[model samples]
Target: MAPPSTSKLEDDVSVAFRNPSHHSNCAAELDNKHVNDQDDYKPERDARVWLIFLALSVSAFLTPLELTSVSTALPTILNDLHGTDFVWIATAYTLASTAVLPMTGGLAEIFGRRPAMLASLSLFGLGSALCGAAQNVPWLIAARAVQGMGGGSMASLTNIIIADLIPLKDRGLISGVLALLWAVAAALGPVVGGALTARPGQWRWLFYLNVPIVGVAFVLVLILLNVRAPTGTFSEKMRRMDWIGNFLVVASSSACVIAITWGGVTYPWQSPRVLVPLILGLLGLVLFLFYEARFAREPIVPFSLVTNRTSFSGYLQTFICPFLTLGVIYYMPTYFQACKLASPVRSGIDLLGFCITLGPAGVLGGVSVSRLNGYRVQAWVGWTLLIIAMGLLSTINEDSSLAKTVAYPALVGVGGGIVYAVASFPVLAPLPVKESAHALAFFSFCRAFAGVWGVAIGGTILQNELSRRLPPSFAESFPGGVALAYATIPKVASLSEPARDAVRAAFAQSIAVIWRVMIAVAVLGLAVSLMMKAVPMHAQTDENWGLEKSRDGELEGREGTEEGSDEKRIEKESIEAVI
Candidate 1:
């Protein structure tokens, strides 16, 4: 792949621009040029690549595991810490990670990818260790913040590294494998957490587990990963660091996530706690946008990349679909325990269907894309399955059978696998190789941000629904607060039959509401997927289409040239319309 051209960048700024198809040869020519400079670019394939994948996969595992694992242990953590703010354990990590995501791409670029990745793993492991040793709720929250910072880099950088090693045509298959790993980690988290909480002195073991894995990953990366730096001196690379841009991104995202997580949970949406941060986050975002557009040498997120309708719409679909899917994953366990009266262990086991199906579906989707080269069909299939899953889930009730629960989650998991397989392809396919890391990072960032909103919105929905459905007789059952008392309630076997029945009825209604909202979100995502223009699957590879060489000897493709001058006219008009 060739480096990006300032000339093309200028042309992209012109009032008239063509679609990507018109310049299909650009990517291919650039790839040939890069291959000619094979001596300068030593592309090695050793067993180390798989080792790197495994190490990064382990780091990635810790992220979703941390998120899901804590749910099963929240009761124990709250009791042991003597704290009512159990939500902080999850929220703090999420908020910190979301805040730091935008910087990972830039950091990887400025520093070598290997160094940046190893640093992320080390920080995450240290934070996990700290979390295990925390004596109080504050310490735990602080430790989680450190973990979040490390997690931010891991989530984004993993994809960036994958993009670096794998060709676009093969990325779908690799991405499928990564998606499977993610699903497994997410699904297994609760079970592992439950087991640890159930065993003596094992709750701390959850965090401790990360230490050895990270240690091994760090050592392997240091020894095996060979990353090429940009053609510049150390000072030149340092100059490109974009510290101000990174700071602005972190501040804005952190504030926004905090507001989202805290709103309607710890504080009223309209209260100062929410309003102040909301306003500040928005202001910081506006400033960041202004800076990126006007002043930064190498902006963290480029507007031109995001402004393209295909990329923009694809990103939105990426964000909203996962937001709804993960929202369900986060809350479904509660429904199983509260409504079905299942044990925590049983609830965790029930979630395995979703996790187990994801691996095969993702692998299938990846293999299918590799053979067929057309992602549009897969996108449609995914959306259809997602809609069906959401629709089925909406029918859940007080006496819903366990079979329906398993079926709905599995369907959604399959859709998730397909979506993950195809979603990033469209977003990354159009860009030059140099921009791939940034694009991948942005894609991951959007998903992480979505996860935060998913948890927040799902929690709010459940809380509100439960509040509305609470029995009048139980209104005085807890003088302190219903939310607090609800937190303490164990699996159904712990409650009397009548009390269990009441809780089940309330939980059933709440889950139904949540599922309805999920359906709406899924429908919106499906609509967005429809709007996406279906590019040919052959367009996935830089080697397939010929273009030219840029400075870095990577493929340089000419895009936005397919439509006639009239189409370019339309592009300008569309930009104006949005403005």
Candidate 2:
């Protein structure tokens, strides 16, 4: 693959620009066979593009809503299902969702975006129906796992579809809109779940609610999402997929998630049950990486993606921001419920400041990046705000004012929002336009993977501290440890004078440790953010994957005509020179 001669490239590009229909022919003449630096390869803005985008936005909204809504209804679900092992309810969904993410890109590449999207939505709706109809703990956990698989895939597909429909320079606004929907859905989830759970036997509706929404997205995609896919027989498509690579990653992720979900909760961190899986999972991930780099023809994660410094830095920033943001979001409610003695509903209401600020900040950050054509500044501002906010949050105590409590978390939300909205820019900026699907699938994987660590770290820190700090008499009631801290929040408010005061102080002190750790994480995110170079964003779409088939066919015919004329002209010049 030698570089094209400068004169030759100039000739091809000059001819291509004259007739936009010949863009593909010109790209084919280039060494890389894809337009890399060109800014004029914009897709035609059609009504169908907006229609497809609307479908994707709905899909994005459904995912986080399902993920967060379940937390508030878990208690009610446990009681109704007679489940003592309530941890499995959440863990199952997380494990399934996280495990399936690495395979989504390959699936999309092999099966096509429309098919992949339709399949994910189908799984999601089926899983939701099963969850709503569950009779016992096992059934519900199994159903949740199914639901999670779909949910995770849906998240990845939404981002991938956006990349297909939108170019990098214009993507900021679309990303902002999706981020807004995601934040709003998250903010509404607990409220929606709590309201449903408050009524007897109504917790089922939490899962059931996703059905109609999925149906709408499903039909919209089935009809309107007519994007191009690789044309091949079923077996040929399957052969193109990186099956072994997918298996290795999925299995390893499941193992790691299980260990993280159970560590310091169901079992001691030192216990062989937790230690063995964690060790094995790490080794498996290493093996998967090796296989992808050395053997797999189509890797789930391409080495080109992380080998570039800017893209690699983007991945690091992506992982760290979510890791800390989710940690803060999970534990902040502990502060309100345990120390401030706010009820579950009240704590959710109290969290409105954080939730509401995040959506708009994300929108603002996105618009700024699009207009300014640089992401580094927003990343710096976000990480700086996060570090400051985490430090301020560490100062919260039982006696902290409502305003102090409200304002600090809101600051965190703002920082997290900006970082989250623009994180994908750096990841996509350094890669070829065709790599968007794989890159974004891994991007979604990073966010989902970070969430597990986020919750685990906060839970582990809080559990260990609560065990050491709570009174021996009070701690004795829960023998397995207060790792399930939310379960303990209700009992904390009902205790007598000295005991209640001691519990609240211990809870505040223990929770402060989480915020303090996040300050360091935020600082690390800042450092990672600096590693990203200001690579120019692409203004083009991958020409092969557009939805306008009639337009594409006409362009192809015109390109063939141009290419034939060029070949004839070259032959004529050769004959004349010989004469």
Candidate 3:
């Protein structure tokens, strides 16, 4: 079979040089060849690729599942461990993942996708194992940190891998598949966690359930995947790992998230506990930029990519869009369970309206991109839907019907599906094939960063609004209330009917305010989407090698050869048989 186009081969070579463990001898044999011999190259579909996809998808399942599932089990874990600092259990993982995400993309570039992915999976599985065995809250939090390291990589690498094998035109379809998988996990997490907690095992099963799936995925990848290592000596590539840049990035991002998570919840926004960390994180971020611009040989994120107008805009949209969409996801379940008085199971099922719609919409968007060669239309349509959804949702109140809640979420899901489908195009379109992995990593980093801030800002608003509004209502309801009355009222279920009504009304009003704020954020996202420049989809290029395709749309050297002349003929035939 004929070898792949020189441009495609360079990407494969880059991966090989990045990780020596996955290097193939064939790569060395063809190292100095200007053009791969058409007769020598073969193309065949490998079932192993599907296996790898399944393995990688497991990580995707765990990442979002961890996010949505933990809420249901938090009460159980807190009760069993006798813990008050419940927020830390969730925050630790988010902090660690957000901190590490910016660098994982660069690390994948330097280390090769396969090795980087395996390492991430191992870390994630190990964290899950530790969490399952935790005897206390501290242990559980620590384990989550480890899990975050792995989780960060998982999110980044999934995008990186798609950019590697799938062409620009086909990416949408693959992305849709990925969205479906993520949606399944998101939709299932709460119900699964509630079931586990309801059983005698408490919350341990939440962590334990990840073990078998992750373990199987890890083993499958190791055995079935054959990745081409980077083209140069392993040590040479290792030197390019950008450790200082990575550390600074982690420090800055972690500090910032910690500040956001703690402010107004654990400490006043103006207090030192919040202010000091926020300042430090900002400084760390500044220093990281300086380091990337001046000192680092291989910056964790290339300044060029960040500076590119289209790419920069794309990243900004990613960061902001999730803030609006995911913030709603985070709070809506609570609104249902707490304000609407739905059971945990019922709330989980209700939340499915949004999550369930995401997969098919994402898939359809993606598949359409393959044919349409652009996603600008889909992007705009999605933002419109999201804005409408947010607007509809903002009108929700204590008296809102369950049907209205479900409709808005499903609309947002449709929008999310479109956004997720097209977001990758801008990031990967301008880069060379060799840089696709890094580009994807950066994309992942931006998404994670946005999610962190989304939750933090949304939570802060809800908490502050609740505190300010609830107390005034409480005071007005009991005109002669003393300090003890103020303290006792919130804790008592047997309060006078009027008092209960007042408190519930206060909650309803506060939540309405929060949802209105979310609506504004969603509108901002819609605006950002409008500014995004639409570029025509182009095939991947390899600038490093100067390989170009011919006018007939074939790579150079493939002009006269029949398809069977390539070695891939045999492999393609085998693949066909399997199919």
Pick the lDDT winner. Answer: 2
User: What lDDT does the true structure give each of the candidates?
Assistant: 0.73, 0.82, 0.70
Better candidate by lDDT, 1 or 3: 1
lDDT, candidate 3, 56-118, per-residue tens: 777777887877777656655665775545556767887778777877766666666678888
Q: Once superposed on the true structure, which residue ranges of model 1 sit more than 4 Å away at CA?
A: 1-48, 230-236, 472-488, 491-494, 536-579
Looking at candidate 2, the ten consecutive residues that score lowest on lDDT are: 30-39
Model 3, residue 475: displacement in angstroms?
A: 11
lDDT of 1 by residue, 1-579 (tens): 233454653554342335544333443444455444331232344566677777677767777777777776766676677665655666788778877888888888777688789889988999999989988889989998998889888888888876666666666777788778878887888798878878545778778887887887788777656655546777888888878988897888778877876776677789899999989988998999899888988888887667666677778878987776676666777777677766556777888888778777887887777788757678779888888898898898868888988888988989988887788877765566557777878888788778777777777777667766766565445444224323634534566778778878888888788888888888888888876665543222222111223445542222322223334344344434433
Clashes of 3: 26
**Poorest 10 consecutive residues of model 1 by lDDT?**
539-548
lDDT of 3 at 86: 51
Residue 121 lDDT (model 1): 91
| Candidate 3 Cα lDDT to native | 0.70
Tens-place lDDT digits, model 2, residues 1-579: 233355764555566557666665443444232234233457887888999999998899997787666765665677677565555676777667778888899889888999999999999999999999999989999998899899889999988988887899898888788879988987897678767877678889998999999999999999899988878899998898898988888888778877876787778899999999999989999999999999999899998899998999889888898766676556776677788887556666677777788899899999998999999999999999999999999999988999999999889889999999999999999998889999999998888878766776677788778878888888888757334465567677689989999999999999998888888999999998989899999888886677756978768856764675565455334333333
Report the number of the highest-TM-score candidate: 2
Instruction: Point out where model 3 deviates above 4 Å.
Output: 1-45, 199-201, 231-238, 471-496, 541-579
* TM-scores of all predicted structures: 0.83, 0.90, 0.81
